[model samples]
Target: MRVVFLGLAVPNMNEYHNMFTELVVEFRNNGHDIMVVAPTYDEKVFGMQVEDGIPTLRVPTLELFGVGKIQKGLATLLLPYQYKRALKKSKIDLNFDLVMMPTPPITLVNVASWLKRKYGSKMYLILRDIFPQNALDLGMMNPKGLAYTYFRKKEKEMYFASDYIGCMSPGNIDYVIRHNPEQNANKLHLLPNWAWLQPNLGQQEIIKIKDQYGLLDKFIVVFGGNIGKPQKMENIVALAKSCTTNKDIFFLIIGGGNEKEYLDRMILREDLSNVRVKDFLSREEFFKVLQIADVGLISLSENFTIPNIPSKSLVYFNARVPILASVDLNTDFGTHLEAIGAGLWAEAGKTKKLKEKLMYLYNNPEKRKKMGENGYQYFKNNLLASMAYENIISRVTNT
Candidate 1:
C-alpha cells in the first residue's frame, strides 16, 4: 500500500517519538510505502528527506506553534494551498492507496478532497481534535461569528471527504453521529490513540532522574504535554495549592505553552513550594520522569462540550502509571479509566473532589501499584500501535 500522511508536524523520526511517527513507522515496518507531508517553519529545511527510512516532504509554511492566535489562524487557513503548491513543485506521485490525516486544521479537507478526486484515494481521518466546537467551548471563538461559520462548514466538508472517520473514544463517536446526522454510521470506527511501547526504566535510572531533579522520597504527580488553554492548567495549579500542606506530595509539571506563565504566576502568588514546573522535555526524558511519577495528571477545561480523549494518557498507560484526571463531564476518559481499573477522576474545576481522589491514591500504595499494573496490561491488550495499523489496513483494503 502507498500511503501519504498529512499532519501539522513531522519530527525527525530518529530523534523524536510521537503517536503519528510511531504509527507511520509501523506502516513502514509492515512493508507499506509511506510518504509524510508536513509543514516546516524553516525555508532551508523545506524539501523531501528520508528520515529513519521514511520519505517525508517538508512543506514551508508560516509559523504555527507558539504564536498568537491570529497568526496561527492565518497559517492554518493557508495550509491547504501551501501543501498543494508544494506537492506540485515536488512532482511526487499522487497515486496513494490511502490518504491519512489527523484533525487540528480541518482546512486540510480541500487537499484531501483534491487528492481523492485526482487519484481515487481512500481518506482516513484520525479524529483527535474536533474544531470550531472546541473553539466555542473554550470561549476562543463566537459561534455567531464568521470564523465559526466558516470552520463549521469546513468541519463538515472534512467529514464528508473522509472514507472513514476514526474516533478516539465512544463519546467522540456519539458526538460526531449526533452532530453530523448526514455522516454514515458505518464509516465511523473507534481507533484509540496508540504508541510504540517502550520497556520500563530500571530503578537505578529512575533514582538518577529523581536525584537530578531534586525529587527524592516525594510522591510525584506529573502533568506533561502541551500546557495550553485546552488543558485548563489552572485546575492543576489549584490542585497543587490544595496539596501544599502535604510536603510528601509534590506536583511536577513538565510542558510549555501560552498558559505556562499564568501557571507560574499562580504558583508564585499562592506561595506554593510543593509544586515545580519544567519546560517540555524530549520523548526519552519525559518517560524517565513518568516512570518515577506516582500519578499522571490530566486536565481539561470544564467549558469543553466536545469529548476529548487526551493522547497524554497513552504515555501514562505505557509507563505503567495510574492516571488521575480532572476532565470535562462530556468525555468518557474517566469512565474508561475506571473500566480498566487504571485510575480515578473527578469533574473538571472541582478542586475538592480532585484533591480527594489524589489523596486516595497517595494513601493507598498497594492500590496505586495495582492500578499501574492494570494500566500496563490494558495498554498491551488494547492500545498497541500494531492494533491501529491492522485496524486501518483491514478496513482500507477490504473496502
Candidate 2:
C-alpha cells in the first residue's frame, strides 16, 4: 500500500528519532511505499528528495520560532493553504491508500478533505495534540473569541473527515468524545505513543558515558526533552532548589525551548550547583545519557486538561531508567508510570511531593533498578514500533 504521512516534524536523519520516524521505517521495511510530506521554513519553493529510502516532499511554511503569539498563530493558520499549494504543485499521483497526519496546527481538515475527495484515500488522524480546547485550558485563547471558534471548527472538521482517529490514551479518547459528542464512536482507536530504543551498553560503556557527561559519581536525574511552557519547568527548578543540600544528587537537564532560558536564569541566580543544563543531543548521545542516568523526569503544566502522554518518557522506559513524572492530575501519564512500577509521580508544579519522590528513589538503589527493569519490560511487551505498525495496518486494512 502507498502511504502519505504528513507532519510538521521534519526529522533530521543524523539526529532526530521519534515515534513517527519509527513507524515510517517499519512501514518501509514491511514493503509499503512511503511518502512523507513535512514542513520546511528554509525553502521558498517546495523541495523533493529521497530520505533514507523513503520519498519525501518538503513543503514550505512560515517559520514558527522566536515569534510572538499573534505571529505564530498567523503562521500556523496559513500552513494548510501552504501545504495544499505544495501538494498541488508537486503534481504527484493522487493515489495514496492511506493519509496519516498528526495535530498541532489543527487546520489539516482542508487538505485531508481534498486528499479523500481526489484520491479516495482513507484519512487517519493521529491525534497527538488536541488544540483550541488546550489553548483555552491554558488561558492562551478565549473560548468565545474568533480565534478559538475558528480553530475549534477546524478541529471538529478534522475529526469528522477522519476515517480513523488514533488517540494517545483512554483519557484522550474520553475527552474527545465528551467534548465532541457528534463524533463517530466507531472511528476512535487507542494508538499509544511508541518507544523503540535498542540499548546495548555494557557496564564499562555505561561508566564511560557517565564519566563523559560529568555524572561519574553523582545520582543523575535526567530531564531529556523540550523545555517548553507546557513542561511546567519552574517546578523542576524548585526541585533542584529543594535538593541543593544533597551533594550526591545531580540534575542533568537537557533540551531547549522557549522556557529553557528561564531555567538557565533561575539556575544562575540561585547558584544551584546541583543543576546542569545542555542543548539537545543526537538520539544516540541521548540514549547513552539515559542509560547512564539513575532517573528520568517527565513534566506537564497543571493548566493542561489534554492528556498528553509525553513520548519522551517512553525513551527512558526503553533505556531501563526509572521515571519521575510531574504531570497534571487530569492526565493519565503519571498514573500509567506508577501503575507499571516504572516510576513515581507527583502533581504538576508540586515541588514538595516531587522532592519527596526524588529523595525516595535516590535513597533506594534496589527500587530504582527494579522500577527501571519493570519499565523496560513493560515497554518491550506493549509499546514498540512494530506493535504500533501492526495496529495501524490492522486499522487500515480491517476498516
Candidate 3:
C-alpha cells in the first residue's frame, strides 16, 4: 500500500515529534510505500526523512507575519488555498490508499477532503491539536464573534471530512464528538501522542550525561517545549524567582516561542542564576539531558482544555523522570497524571504551590525517583510510539 501523509509539520521537525519517522519506519518495514508532503516557510529542512529510509517531498511555504493579528489572520485565511497549491505540487505518479492529515492549521483537512474526493483516498485525521477553539478558550480569540463562528464552522468541516479519525487522547474524543456529533464514534480511535525515547540508557548512563553536562549538582526541574503565552509563564517565572535562595535547585527552560524573548528579559531583570534558558536542542541532546534531569515541568494554561495535551510529559516518562504538571484539575491531563502517580499538586498554579511542589521534588529524591518509576511503567503500558504504528496499521488495514 502507498500512503500519502499530508501535513506541514515534518520540515519544521523541531516543532514535531518522532511520530512521523516512527510511522514512516513501521510502514516501510511492513512493505508499504510512504510519501510525505510537508510545507514550510523556507526552502527545505535539513535532517528530515533520514529515519525509516522513507522518501518525502516538501511542498510550499507560508509567508511570515511580521507581527499582528490581522496579518496572521490573513495568512491563516489563505492557508487552505496554500495547502491546495501544495497538494498540486506533490509528485504522486502512483495513487495513495490513505490520506493522513495533522492539525493546528485545521485547513489541512481541505487538502485531505480534496484528495479523498478527486483520487478516491481514505482520509484519516491524525489530530495533533484541536484549533481556533483552543485559541478562543485561551482568550486569544473572541468566542462570541464572526471570527469565532468562521473558525468553528471550519473546525466542524475538518472533523466531518475524515473517513476515520485518531486523536491523542479520550479528552480529545470528548471535544470532537461534543462539536461534531454526526461523526461515527466507531471511526474514532484513541491514538495516543507517542513517546519515542528508547530507554536502554539506564540511570547510570543518564547520570553520566548529567555529570558531563555539569547538571549533577543541581536538582534539575526542566520545562522543555514552546515558551508561549498559553504557558501563562509569568507565574512560572515568579516561582523561579522565589526559588532563588535554593542554590541546589535549577530550572532549565528549553524551547522557543512567541513570548520567549519576554521570558528571557524577565530572567535578566530578576538576575536569575538558578534559572537557565536554552534554545530547543536536537532530539538526542534534549532527551539525553531529560533522562538525567530530576523532574519534568509540564504545564498548560488553566483555560486551555481543548486543543492541547502537551505531549512533552511522555518524554519525562521515557527518560524515567518524575513530572510536575500544572494544568487545570478538571481536565483529563491532571487526572491521568494523578492516576499514574506521575506527580502533580492539587493547589492551583500559584507561585507558592509551584515553589512548594518544586521544593518537594528537590528535597526528596527517593519520592521523585518512585514517581519516575511509575511514569516509566505508564509509558511502557501506554505512550510508546511503536504502539501508534500497530494501531495505525490495524485501522488502515481494518484488521
Candidate 4:
C-alpha cells in the first residue's frame, strides 16, 4: 500500500518522538511505500527537524508560534493543499492509499477531499488535537459570533472529509462524539501512543549525562519537551523555587518552544539555579540524557478542556523513568496513571501540589522503579506503534 502522512508540524521539533517515523518504518518494512508531507520552516525546526531515511517532502509554510498570530492563521489555510500538491508531484508513480492526517491546520481535510475526488483516495484523520475547540479552550480562538461560525464550519468540513478518524484516547473519542454524534463509530478508532526500545546502559548512562550537565550528584527531574504555553511552565517554575530548600533536587528542563525565550527571561528574573533550562537538545543527546533522568514531567495547562492524552508520557515510561504530571486528575491521564500504576498526577496549575509530588517521587525510588516498570508493561501491551499500525493495515486492506 502507498501512504501519505499529512502533518502540520515541522520536520524537527515534532515532539511525537518520530511517531510518524515509527509508523512509516513499520509500513515500509512490511513492503509498503510511505511518504510524508509536513509544514516545517527551515529556521524554526524544533523537535520535528527534517529527518532522514524516509521519502519526505517539506512544503514551504506560514509558520506558527511566537507573536505572529496573523501570519500563522494565513499559513494554516494554505498548508493542506500545498502538502497534497507536493506529494502528487513527487510521487508520480505512486498515489496514496490512505492519507493519514493530523492538524492545528485543518487544510488537510480539503486536501484529502481533493485527493478523494481526483483519485478516489481515502483519508484517515489522526485527530491528535482537535483544533478550534482546543484552541478555543486555550484562549487562542476567539469564540465570537462570526469567527466562531466560520471556524466551526471548517472543522466540520474537515471531519466530514475524513473517511476514517483516529483519536489518541477514549476521552478524545468521547469529545469528538460529543461534537459529531452522527459520525460512524467504526470510523473513529482509538489511535494508541507508542514506545521505542531503549539502549540498556544501566546507571552508567545516567552518571555520564549527569556529569556532562553538571548535575551528576543532583536529584534531577527532567521536563524534556516544548516549554510552550501548553506546558504552563510557571507552575513548574514555582515548584523549582519551592525545592530550593531541598538543595539536592534540581529541575532540568530541556526543549524548545515559542515560549523558550520567555522561559529564559523568567529564569533570569527569578535568579533560579535550581531550575536549569536548556534549549532543544540534539536527538542523539536527547535520548541519551533521558536515560539518566530520575523523573520526567508531563504537563498540559490546567483549565485546558481540549482533550489531550499526551504521547510523551509513554515515551518516558518506555525509558523506565516515571512521569510527574502537572495536569488535572479529572482527565483520562490521571486515570491512566492509576490504571497502570505508572506515576503520580497533580492539579495542572498547582505549584504546591507539583512540589509535593516531585518530593515524594524523589524519596520513593522503589515506587518510582515500580511505576517505570508498570509503564513499560503498559506500553508493550497497549501503546506500541505496532498496535496502531495493525489498525491502519486492517482499514487500508478493508480486512
Candidate 4 C-alpha lDDT tens digits along 188-253:
877776655656556866687679888878887888878777777887787887888898888888
**Per-prediction TM-score:** 0.98, 0.96, 0.88, 0.90
Candidate 1 per-residue lDDT, tens place, 1-399, comes to 999999886687767857888899999999999999999877677789888888898888999989998999999999999999988889888899889999888998899999999999999999999998998999889989999999999999999899998999999999999999998888899999998788899889899988988888899999999988999988998999899889899999999998899989989999989998998988887987899999999999999999999988888988989999999999999999999999999999999999999999999989999999999999988999999999888888887
lDDT winner between 3 and 4, please give it.
4
Candidate that would win on TM-score:
1
Q: Which candidate model has the greater TM-score, 2 or 4? A: 2
Cα misplacement distance, residue 170 of candidate 4 (Å):
0.8
- In model 1, the runs with Cα more than 4 Å from the true position are none
Q: Residue 36: error of model 2 in Å? A: 1.1
CA shift of 342, model 4, Å = 0.9
lDDT at residue 331 of model 3 (Cα atoms): 55
Candidate 4, residue 255: how far the Cα is off, in Å = 0.9
Q: Which candidate, 2 or 3, has the higher lDDT?
A: 2
TM-score of 2: 0.96
**lDDT, candidate 2, 195-262, per-residue tens:** 67586578899998888877788999999989877888888888989998898889999899888888
Provide the lowest-lDDT 10-residue window in model 3. 44-53
Candidate 3 lDDT over residue span 227-298, tens digit each: 877777776677789988888878888888788899999989999888889898987788877776788887
Residue 330 in model 1: lDDT:
95
- List where candidate 2 sits over 4 angstroms from the true fold: 14-16
